[model samples]
Target: MTVLLRSSTTLAALLLLLPKTFVLGSVKLVMQNGGASQCQTLWAKHTIAVGNVCVEADQRNPEQLIVSYETRDGWKLDDAHLWIGRNISEIPFMADEPADDSKRSVQQQQHQDQPYQKQQQVDLTQFPYKKEDLAGKHENFGFVVKLQHLGYSCPDTQAFVAAAHATVTARSSIRNGNTPTLQSAWASHIEPMKKHVLQGATMINRINQWQDFNFTLVCDIKNDPPEGAPKRHFANQVPK
Candidate 1:
């Protein structure tokens, strides 16, 4: 079973470790020239995968927001989870540290030393969805929720955080039919695995394979003035 948890400090550190000239899949992270109504773009970083993320206020309804994620060739996204709040720590999935202290330390050191390793490793035990829920379903990858939905509103500025994870597979492994579906394995193993982890299981018999793309974007909301409001006029231009 693959288990993964990242503390907020680690997430912040990873963000800093990313290259200043990082390139997203198809979209580049650059300043948007249009007004607040325009879509804002951000870069997502991972060891083996690249992602492009976008957030924008819906043109049809300013109160709604649209968030989208895209990946480059040779990689497919399995699932994505989003959290909106004032800070990254507010995200539940990112707030928890690994239960094992030694493992955490080693993993942290490895990541710090080699931030861009070619091999992809992801932990999806905490993720809620099954593969069938997202695989091959293009629309499920993006989110379209109201600004005020679930009491999260775009008052002035808010942080939009996303965690997207997927598994990397080789054609030879699949041709041999030795590869197992992550969700299937997760479904059958999670319960027992949880017990084992809580009991301090330390077996590392299989190679853990998964990739995570994480990013954050700050959104600024600009609402038009209310209708029927009195207009301001210069003293010289007043009705005379």
Candidate 2:
């Protein structure tokens, strides 16, 4: 499973419209650089399987599942941040704390020690999905009603904040008048949530496999702006 997951490159690309169809499918974690996946699975007996995960769906009846991921790399995350928490409201960890001086010093030292610093590769197709490749499948915000991680289900949609880590995949929906630029911007903003999320996804004590975990992003929630306030998309973020 580890070898197969790592070898496949399509899973990490959230919005890349491949030649084949993209079915909003099961969720998976971003593949790490080392032996994290192998170590966690092999040593499962020594540690907990699920930690800080709660996406809801009826395993027996797969039809009940509304939330689904676009690709293995559902959300746009850097090498540092991968699979994040269920909902935006759930802060990953010490979200507010300033990084200690020691941590910063170590990172700087590591950079100095490295012979050659590698740059994060930017996917050309990441922002503007080639119109030709889409095959007429317009982009729209699919509602993520709930999320289910390893051991828990995050169904508390009432308090849900912004969109979390997952990427905005192509779906067969009417574009209406939605701007692609705005969509790209929104994806960029949510990219940071994945940093430090590995605590929940890595190690034997945590969920070793975040592979193919799916959730539903609730769509068409009207913000109903009053007196011509700024137009909004997500109903969850609108004020009461």
Show how many residue pairs clash in every candidate, following the order shown: 2, 28
Which candidate number has the best TM-score? 1
Q: Which tens-of-lDDT digit does each residue in 41-126 have in candidate 1?
A: 22222222333445544556544556565544323445554444444343344343434434443434445443322223233444
Among all candidates shown, the one with the greatest lDDT: 1
Name the lDDT of candidate 2.
Answer: 0.26
Clashes of 1: 2
lDDT of 2 by residue, 1-240 (tens): 011112233333432323222222332322234221211110111221211122333344422322221222112111111233445333233224443445433344445433322222333233111222322232222223323332222111122222222223222223445432212211221112222322223321222121212232321122224566875556668564
Worst 10 residues of 2 by lDDT: 36-45
Worst 10 residues of 1 by lDDT: 184-193
Q: In lDDT terms, how accurate is model 1?
A: 0.35
Tell me the lDDT of model 1 at 195: 19
